[model samples]
Each structure stands twice: as structure tokens, then as C-alpha cells.
Target: MIDKVIEIEPLDDLDFGKVTAELRSKRREQDTIVLFHPSDSCQENLHHFIAGAKKIHGSMFDYGVNWDDLIWDIRGFESTTSLKDLTHASNVLFTQDNGKGPKIKVSRKDEVPFAEPFATFAKAFVTHRHNEKPKSHSNHMVAIKALRLLYQELPNSLTPCVSQLLPEHFNKAISCAMGTQAKPTLYVTGVHLTAIAESLDEYRLTATPMTWKNPIPRNYKHGGASQNRGGKEAKKERAKQLPKTDLLLFLAALWGTYEEIEERDKALVCMSIILLLCGFRMDEFIGLDLNCIPSREEYDKLPLEIDPETGTLARILRIRVLAKKKGHWDEKIVPHCTVDTIYIAVERLKALSKPQRLTAQIMLEEGKWNRFLEFDDDDYLTSREVKEHLGFPGASATNTISTLALHGIQRDPSSLKRKTRFRVGDIHDGFCDRYRERISPIINGFGHDELIIPIWEFLTLRYLNQYTPKERLNVFAEPL
Candidate 1:
């Protein structure tokens, strides 16, 4: 593998190819052997592993996809499966169908055994959840957090099993939950806990028995008088769940003011406009694919209609939106206008960043990020040169690019304390920015009326998307 990336090696005068060959000897003969990774403890950790599998991406991973055996270890231990592994990873990831999710922090401290009941129960509950269909990883994390919080509120003496949990324990945990999550979130957390508690007496994971009764109301949404008791302040908060008017008007003005903005900032302007148009969750935006929209031919197949009021050509473009975190589902949008606005913005944005996307494609295929397309690998470049290559010139650009290591090589092999030299191939974690074809402030384009762009597909194009009802989208959201 040609994977050794030198950070900075200066290029000086050389007359011909022969001259270059003449001085091709080692700059210093006192070199030592180095390994690719200095500190990873790999498969050697296999012995300490009790039994678990790496959470690999599944073939049956999408919405309506069949249950594949490889999707997870449904036996209920995949998330925290690395219990006894000797690898240096200090965290355990949440179980995910595709390979993206948050990780829970792990410690070798006493908390490990103390929290075992919660972790153990979480593994079972989540496994049971998968039996129906994969729950969103965000929801899974919330369930785990709920359990962890409940465990924390318990007395110091270690609870032997989940069945030992009591009513007072739940009350203390609900108090903690109220502080961190809203009523809806609290409700879901309560549901998961109740599910396990209800089943624990009969279907105990062990000989341990469950005697705890849930305090949370099953009718939480409408049980406002009983469950929602923060007095006037709580009522004020619930009344104001929608976004404030002044902030919203300021955002809406941005859509009309698009043409007046600077050319360099066109992409983000279009993005904010799309976000206003489509209520996307942040993760969904990042995982958007290039072919998110159907072909003109496919789109034409949808029932056609003309805009009678506008007296202009109108069509409902059935935009293909990727919900990366949430499983894909169909949504009905109302009176979304102007295919011209969305189609043009998407195409133009795609055009601008096509080069970066192609480069990313190469990076993905080769599993390497060694060199820029036109730059010499042996030549050294400064931060200024790199900044210029990326386009954009100013104090702000210099300030940002100056801090980049940009694939620079360090002087000391044993220590990262040494200064780094910049090279053309020194791109940072640029490849990790998903669904983006172009790089910059993303891409430049204009939008109008409505366009539901995915959050991640085009760094230029992504936005957090959800199956928002048309009414709430018009009302806007409260300050996040």
C-alpha cells in the first residue's frame, strides 16, 4: 500500500530528469523502521471477548427491506457487546443497522458493574425492539439514557437485577428525566421501561423477579392535569412550542433576498431556504445521495396539474429524499411550488461540486487519500497554496487554512510535538463529509418557494429532513 503521506517536503531547482535522479539518495542515512499504526491492539483482544459481533452494515438495511440475519445479534448484546475485549476503544457504540450511531462512554471504574443491570436490560429491550422493526438509533440511545438515569437515582447498594427496581426508584428517575427531556421524550422513555417491567415478572431474563410498578401515566399526551404539573410556566412553555414570529420573518426574508447576496455564499443561502421549505433533521441532510430526484421521465409519470392561479407552468416533483437515520417512508407535501426553482438549484449545485464528489468517489474506491489529482506527491506546498487550490482568498481564509496540518509530515517520528510541513495532498477529513460532491461553504445555487433537500447528500445539498406535517412546518419551530 502506497499510504505513507509526507506532510511537507520542499522542492528546489533541478534542471532535468537526470539531475533529479542524481540527488535521489536518502537525505539522511540514519533512518529507523516504522509501522503503520503505533498503538492499536487488534485481534489479540479476541480472547477476552465473551461473545459478540461487529455491527456491520446490512443488505436488508433500508425501509421495507427484509430481516437479514447479519443486521444484528438479536440475542440482545450487540450494543455493549465489547464487554471483555482488550482493544483500546474506551466506548461502546449503540446498535445501528447502517454503520452510524452514537457511542456510550465506557469506564473501567466501579460504575461498570453498578450500571450492569441497566446495560443488560437495555440490550434485551433493544433486541426486543428489533423483533418488530429497527427502532431509530436516536430512540435507542434515549432508551439507554433513560435506564442509565434510573440506575443513577437508585441507592448506592448495587441492585442485583432489573427486577429489583421499585416505585421510588422510578419516581427519582422521572424527576431526572423531566429536567433533560420534554413530555414526548419522557413518554417514550417511560414506555420502554414499562415494557420491560411488565414482562419481567413472567419472562425474567434470570431467576430474578420484577416487582416495580410504573409511575408514568400511559396517557401522558392528554393527561396534562395529572402529568404536566409545572403550573403557569409549564403551560407557557407548551403554548410556545412553535417558533417565534420575528425570527421566522427574518428567515423568510432570506428567500426573497437571495439574488442580492454575494456569489460566494449562494449555496448556504439556498440551503437555509430549503430548510425553511422542508423540515429536515440534521443527520438526514448529510446522507443525501446524488440521485435523490427521479429523472424528468419518471417525474412526468406522476399525475400532472397546472397552476391555475399563477398562470405559469407548475408540476409536483416527487423528490427522492434519503432519511439516513430514520428508515425511509413516504410523505405527502401540500402546494409545494415551482419545479424550476428546486430543479435548477439541485442541478447547479451538483455541477459546481461534481469534481470534489468524483475525487471522493476515487478516495472511497481506493480507500486512500494520498494525493490531489493534479499536484505532484513529492512537492511541498504551503497553507496559502492549499487555500488557493480550494478557492477563496482573504484574511478569514488564511486564518482557517493556516491551522490545517493538511497532511504535513512531522519532524519527530516518535512524537507529534514537532511542527508540520504542508503538502498539496494534505487534505484533512474532507472525505468524511457525506453526499457532498463539491467542497467549499458547500455549493452555490438559488432556490424558491419549496425544495426538500436531504441533510447530507450534498455537503452542498444536505439538510436535516423529517416527515413533518404541513401545518407545523408553516408555524415554524421554537428556538432550538
Candidate 2:
């Protein structure tokens, strides 16, 4: 075999090319051996190994030259100067695939004991082995075993000599890749080092250093666009439901008939509607006060309007009423009389819940009496006092909402003898406003006598008229 040098031209005048040129020039002058990694050894995939080499060179292996430059003389001569010849000379050893070469079969049972972790690292290693190829599902088993060996051996071989002798490129590549997952990231050799440390007194072991890279995209979505796992699924499912009109009626009937629910249920429902309609998060829902409710007058001034001349008279009449959220209320509303149900509901709820006014003398007397009152005096109400009155069941807000939504009865508080008479009225006001905004256009467009809507949409349409029903449902409903 003739030791000849072939000048490989630079692809670009970059820092990388400069580095390669320096290394090649030095190697040619000194005749310090240059090895071209073979394509036949289990580790012969030049692209994968080189990708890893490049990655490492950028980081901990900055002083190390890329193996690509050493292969200049062997580029076109496949039979004589190839990766196979280099493998025979043992200048380059691959991260073996089972006991077989590069294209061998991978067996699950033959995998390292920590199979999942081993496989995870193996995939990453193979990715580097194949020139950092985009990960695919093919031949994952082989990759797993190779990583297991790397993780098993690298760390316990001691510092100075062991670390110096080891290929820093291989070590760095393995460590960097492990950082990509949500696991106890074992450095390319940390786990192996720790295990080996027990048997040998010569080396030190440490966990893989925590490393990170920019996130890579994954196929988290299961199916089509909106039908995928998350918010899309919720939207799709909500769209399939018969519409809000019927759902609200059902809920209203349930509220009116079920007497078991106390004021707590009413409060929870109030918050739920506000969040679903308004796109409020859990914390926002919990923090709401009575003040957020909009006035009926303000609601009437919203942008929603219906043109009386466009559709059939009966059709126009049937669909003219619509719902509107407070934010979308604008000045362009025409034909003065669009009715807003949500605003009406809020006003009604507030009226029923308002405290009765007292004369000055009576208030003075009551205050004086309260000063001498005991725990059972029936005057001052503590947080516990209110909860007891409302029959609240839980310690935390999450549990409280969960309990109320599950078994609580819905009620129209504006009616006599119902704690939600206040909320019941508010619902009507809010619903009316939302209905005016949402329905009138569709009714004027299609000329329908009645409308069908989802319960969540009914609430959201009241608040913002922005989110779809499924989004509202996710905000409003718990897992149950």
C-alpha cells in the first residue's frame, strides 16, 4: 500500500475549511498516520460518525480535527483505499451493532438490561453514526445495544490517561444527544462509569453532564389538523354536538329542577361560564369578582345589528335575537333594537344578590350589638360561616370546582327560593346579548325559526364571541 497524499479542495472558505487545511498540512509534513474510517465495520457509516465528529469538534473536541479531511486520497478508489481496509488495520473501531457489522439484525432480548434508556441513547448514537441523519423508526434495536456498550464502558476508565486516550468526539456526541430526552441523562459514559467504578479502584465515575440543544420537531399530533390530540380534538368534538340552544335549555331545565345544589354550585357555574366565554384561565376564573359583569345599557350599545329588509319577515323575526360579548360591542350596530341576553342576565343576578339597605339608626344599633356578640350570635359571618351556609365541601379551589360541576344542580336564581336567582338573571342577560350578536347574522343569512348551540359556546359567545364551543368546554369542564 503506497502512502500517497491527495489534495482535497475546500468546499467553502470557512473557519471549518481553515481548520481542516491546517490539520491536513501538518499531518502531510510529519507523516503522522491519517486514517479514513471504513464503510464496512459496524461503525463504518462515514456520514453518521462524521456528523457526530463535527458536532463534537464544535464543542468539547474543538482541538480535534474532523476525520473527513484524512480521506482525501481514498475518495474515488473504492476497492483499495476504503473504510473496509481501515477497519482491517484497526485504526477505527465502530460502536458495534450486536456482534454483527453495520447492516446486521437487532434483537430486543439481546439488548442491555436498561432497554428503554439504552435504546434511546442508541438511536442518538446511530443518528451520529449516520452523519446525524434525521431519526427514523428503522433498525432502532441495533442502535440501542451500541449505546448500552458506550454507556457501560466510558466513565470508569479513569482521568488523564483514560480520558486522553478515549475519542473525545465520541464521548461528547453521546453526552450531547442524551440531553434531548426527559430522563436522568447519563453522560455518554457516566452510567457506565458508575457501574464500572464499583469493580475497579483506578477510575472515577460521574453522571453525564447536563447538555441541551434547540428543540427538534416531533409528530405530537395524532390525526388531521383540528382533529389532533389537543385543543383541536376539543373543537372538533364540540362542533359535533347539536349546538348551544338545545344544550342551554337542557342545562336550564336541570338547574330549575335540581334543588340539591346550594349557592356554591351557583358560584362555580358563574365562574365556569365566565371563563369558557371569556377565555379565562383557572387562576383568572378563581379571582373573578362581581364587578366584571357588564351593564345592560353598555351591552345595548354593541356592534351587532340585523337588517330587517334582507330576509323573510318570519325568518328575520325568528333569528333576530342574538348573543354578544362585552369586548366586541362596537358603534356600527344599526336598527336600534338588538336585544342582548347576557347583559340582562348579569344585571338580574346582581339585583337578586344585592344587600338590603338599612336606616342609620338601625345600622348603628346592629353595629353596637355585633361588638358584644359571641360566636353563635348570628351576626358576623367568617369564611367558614359562608362556606357552611353554602355547604362547601372542600379545602382547595380545584376540588371545590370539581365537586360543584359534577353533581350540583343548575338553577335559575332569579326565580323564588333559589340561591342562584342572582346568577339565573345574569345568565339571561348575558345570553340575550350574546344571542343578539351571534344569531342575528346567521338567522338573517339562512332565515331559521330556531337555533341550536352548545352550552359552552353559549357562555363564551356571551363573554367574547371569539372561541369555539370545544375551547370553552376545555376551560369550563374538568376531566369528569
Candidate 3:
């Protein structure tokens, strides 16, 4: 059964000024919570408001004012009071018995001329931003940081609002950021600003004020020419320092050393090999449940499928990995293992999976899981423990360096003089290079049309651009 149809106007179509007026009218009529969508954009707007308030009033702006608190405060404010009184009440809530507490008074003369417009704009902006598609966490963070910087540049006496923004303000803010951050970072910040402008434009709040020419060039080398040059030289040096033969010898030495150490150390080395071979990110494997490992039956079935043309065993083992970007599970087909390293590693982990060991593993994984895994894992493992296990980036680089030293290979001084350390990522790069070398001859012998399945699977797994061979080669050659 259907009742009378109630058609709600789309927020984008509604006039921003009219909507704010309606909201003000509603506040005057009733003191009740108004429902608003808790989208990322709305959340960001609330965050910006609180940050602006803090900058203006410091400790006077209550730290406990969340979304509901702000909503309720706005709704309950005395309609006849000046905007200054509303601002003061919103910033500082008094809970003492109404008349018994310190008598609070606000004068209309003390009010900033733009306070009312600011409040109206804030409400309208957030409402317009509501129910929007969510942006990535990294994108949201950049937006918040940009907003915070913009707020800091504003005079403390005035309330912050989107309408206050100007092209000059953005230019100045971006210029300040450029002093400390790289061009790529500035470009990313510019992207955040553009996103904000787009949001504002959708709401018809203000014509996007971000018309300033972006200082960072579109084709600008990410780390500058010198750094890029140094990176290529370092990559070559690493490749020369520890070629395939040296890498195998290093692994053998590591295995021999692990035999003398604890079971945990042995498990770590095995995991490291799996990570290198399978191209698994540290975060992907770190929190993996023991159940993720294939059973003996499953392992037995792995090599059953064979390619009709080449008579080569086809990939059958598939593992579910968590996609960090979308927060969903994606199936990653296990690549052809050149050796029995990953299998041995899986078995070692299974053998080491006692209740205490599982608990420790969970703790380590949870502690190490971060936005970029850039933070120190010292809380989970000590420097010596990390070195012994070859877990951290620094440890991996040190292992390679030390292994090269043992082989009487003279390490290039330039390789060790970089800001970023060599990591398991370097090993992944080398793996891709080797994989390409191995596959190129096969592709040359048999046309790509004949080996389409293997080629497609390989390209998909590696996240390579399917249509562009140059892009694929670049990705394969580039050090992650």
C-alpha cells in the first residue's frame, strides 16, 4: 500500500542561500536534531569547523563538540541573540543550573559582521556535501590538511567559511607548502583543492575560487632530476652488487644462519622469501590468518591443470588478499614458483603456529599496519630481532649490503647514500625483471595470440597496462 508521495528535491538543484535560510527558519521553529548524512565530505567540513574554532578561540572552543553536539547546539541557540552570542555558546557550553551559574551576557555590538553569514555558509556547505560519494582515505587526509592550512592563514577574530576563500589565499598557502614539501606533494595538494572547488561548485555555494595557475609542472620528475638520476644509478648498483647468483647464495647463508637461531627467526626468513617471490606487500601477508594457507589436498591439486599448447603447468593456487584501497578481498593467483621457497615457507609457518605464536603474530601485524607502513616497528620487534629475521626495510637493505660484502663485491658508495632504503620492494622489482626475461623468449617463440591466457594472467596479476607495452616494460624496470 502506498500513501501520499513526498518528493524531496535533490540538494544539488536547491539554491544554497535558500537552503540555509530554510535551516535558519527551522532552527527558529524547533529545537530538535536534524538528520544529515555522515559522508566523508560532511565529516571533513565538521573537522574544518572545529579546527577553525580551535585556531580562533584556543582552549575556549570545547574539544568535546562532535557532530551531534554541534547540531544540537545550533538547533537550541536563542534565535533572537546576535551571531556573537551563538558563536560563544557553541564554543563554550555551560551546564550549571540555568540562573545559579555565572550570569553570561552577549552584546550585539561585539558581533563580527560576517559571523552570521559564516554560520549559515558552514551549515549550507555541510548539508550540500552530505550524502556524497566517499573519497579515498588518503584523499580525505590531504583535504583536511589543506583546509587546516587555509584556516591558519585566516585572521583569528573572524569565523572561517568557504565563501571567504580566494585565489590569492590558495596561492599563498600552496607557496608556503612548497617551501617544505616536494612538487609532487604540492600537486597532490592542488588536487585536493580542485576536489574541494568541485564540491563547492556542485552546491552552487561559490564559483570555484581556485583559478591560480598550478606551480608544479605536470611532467615534473617526482623526486627532482638529481634524485631520479641517483635512483637509477643506485638500482643498477644494487643489481650489479647482488645478481641472481649472489641472491641465491645470500638466501642459502640466511637459511644456514636461521638454523642456529630460534624457530621464529627461521619462520621470518621463509616469509621474506615468500614475499619476494610472490610479490606480496608486507601488509598483505603480515596479518594473514593461518587458514589462508592451502591444505595438502589443495596443494596436490595445484599442478593438475596444464596448458594444451605449451604443455606447461597452469597456475591453480589462488589466495585472497585484502585490497587496501577499496577495503575488499581480491583473489591473487599464485605465480609460478621458480623454486620450492614459498611452499617451504608456508609449511614452516604452519609448524610454528602455536597459540602463543599466533597471538604474537596478530600483535605484530596489528601494530605494524599503518597508512603507509612508514612508522617504526620497534614496538613489535627490536633492531637486532629485525636484522636477524630480515623483516624491516632497513634490515633487508643491510642484509643485501652485508651479503655483497661477504662475496668480496665492492659496493658503490652512491647506493648507500640515499634517503629511501632498499627493501623487499627491490626484490619484487628484480623478480619482475627475471619473470619478464623468462617470458620474453616464450612470447617470441609462440605468438602472443597463442599464449594469450598466460600473458593476460601475468599482466593482470602485475597490474600492468594491457594495451601499452612501453608502460608494462617501464613498470617492470622501475624499482618500487
Between prediction 1 and prediction 2, the one with superior lDDT is 1
How well is each residue in 359-441 modelled by candidate 1, as lDDT tens digits? 44454444234335565544555544554554444734444343343323322233223223354333423332221232211
Off by over 4 Å in 2: 1-216, 220-250, 257-260, 275-281, 300-341, 344-480
* TM-score on alpha carbons, each prediction: 0.49, 0.25, 0.44
Runs of candidate 1 with Cα error greater than 4 angstroms are 1-133, 149-159, 166-186, 205-213, 218-253, 256-259, 263-265, 278-288, 295-315, 323-326, 329-336, 351-359, 366-371, 378-480
TM-score of 3: 0.44
- For model 3, how does the per-residue alpha-carbon lDDT over 109-193 read when each residue is reduced to its tens digit? 4322223334444333333332233232234335555654555454543555665566676677777677756667777776665
Candidate lDDT values, in order: 0.43, 0.31, 0.43
* Model 3 error, position 160 (Å): 2.2
Best by TM-score: 1
Compared with the true structure, the alpha-carbon lDDT of candidate 3 equals: 0.43
